[model samples]
Target: MSPDLWSFALAVYARPDVEAACLRLQSAGANVCLMLCGLWLEQRDATCDDRRVHQLRQITDPWDRDVVQPLRALRLQWKEAADTDPLLKGMREQIKGMELEAERALLSRLEGMAQGWARNSKESSDWLEALAGEAANLNRDALRVLRVAAAGA
Candidate 1:
């Protein structure tokens, strides 16, 4: 793993909250593939040859096998209802148009990780931190949009 990647992963693993969140998120049947895939896509601009990418890819299988199926099932669960929910309709449309490059970028990062880096809890923590930070930023933006919508201004 490159120094940056190694450091990022280490930081992610160091934070107890992040570590717990990762495990909880995984166990809670959260969409790991989609989450990681989204992260990878979002971070592609800053990524490059690195060991972390490789390990990330390796982990994606569990997500592909265990997570996506259920999500797809749920997505179709309320097709009629979705028509009334613009958010659901937009989300469905976005999912349908999800860019493949983002998915591939995340898989590449995981795959690129060196063996030691991939196995290290500290390293994983660092990566999680980066992911969490990105998520937080997204939440902030979404909240801002929500506030604006709520204000009707």
Candidate 2:
């Protein structure tokens, strides 16, 4: 991982829709960095962390799948809008960048905790709890960014 991995993660984490989608993915048993990285890689047309991303991609539960679809769709929508509108495009790119940087920053600490348990282990409930804590922090940071962005507008 690069030294700026956290920066990359934070870039993605700045987006409200991205953050919300990630929380939904976390609620559905996906790791936060993996989820955000999946979106990042998808946006850049690069490869994802295949094992973790693949596991998420293979989720068969309808409820879980449904929750993530909005995330996937939001990424596409943001990407598309970002490519077109000159006015909002810069902000869209900023949000995507923050999302990635936030994930990278937060995951440096969290991934170690996440790797301790087996993928199919019974630690999911606990993982969800931990994720909620992380999500709250991310949400708070995002809200601050939103306030600044809104105030500047």
Candidate 3:
């Protein structure tokens, strides 16, 4: 696995079924960035706690809502039209790039927030499950895919 969060996320995302599973979790209202961060924490053997989770959420929620979501919505909104119109397709692709940039920025912020934490001396915390909360319950298979992918990554 990569040392940095962005590279770590890319590696995990490249694993088989990982993208599909992440999309499923995202559709189910899980923040893909948060999930990736959780996996990163798990890999680092960092202990999960309520305060940390809440702190992460505080950093994530607004940025995702205000920055990423709008870009994504605009890009998705142009999907069908962009399929037929080359010009529209180009613009939509740009929006997609912006969305990715936004996500990458979010991951950086998450990494910064987590950087000071020391690794646990004992067993690893289930950051994925703790971070996912009820969303994990709703998307068990998807979550499982992520866990397997993260393990491989």
Candidate 4:
């Protein structure tokens, strides 16, 4: 396994069914960066208690809200125009890259924060659920699918 969060995330995200499950969770208002962090923690066998969840959220939410969201918004805002305007299309691609890089930065920070945490034998599904909490639009089935994918089941 990779020693860093970004590489770990890339590996897990490429696993079967994970991409679709992540997209489903993302559409339901879950922060994908946080979700990826949760998986990273799981891979590290970290404990998934409420306090840890809260701590993780505190570390990630601000960067996700302030930086990543804005870039995503800008890229999305150009979606329609990008279809026709070649210049806008190029600019939108650049914004998309920046957004991904911002996410990578957040993952790096999250990994740093979690580096010294004690590891446990907790189930990855439990960690995933704890990190994800209860999103209004993420139904139980969707969560189950996510869990299955996270577990590589």
- What is candidate 1's CA lDDT for residue 80? 71
- Each prediction's Cα lDDT score? 0.42, 0.44, 0.92, 0.79
Q: Which regions in candidate 2 have their CA more than 4 angstroms from the true location?
A: 1-4, 47-153
| Candidate 4 lDDT tens digits, 11-36 | 77887777878777787778787888
In terms of lDDT, model 1 sits at: 0.42
Per-residue alpha-carbon lDDT of model 3 for 63-108, expressed as tens digits? Answer: 9999999999999999999999999999999999999999999999
TM-score of every model versus the real structure: 0.27, 0.31, 0.96, 0.87
User: Which has the greatest lDDT?
Assistant: 3
Clashing pairs in 4: none
Ranking by TM-score: 3, 4, 2, 1
What tens-digit string does per-residue lDDT give for candidate 1 at 22-81? 445455444333334323323333332234445454566565565455555556674777
Identify the superior model by lDDT, candidate 2 or candidate 4: 4
Q: Candidate 4: count the clashes.
A: 0
Tens-digit lDDT string for candidate 2 (47-126): 22335433433442342345434444565577767777886677666666655454444454433323332333222222
TM-score of 2: 0.31
Lowest summed lDDT window (length 10), candidate 4? 121-130
Model 3: colliding residue pairs: none
Clash number for model 3? 0
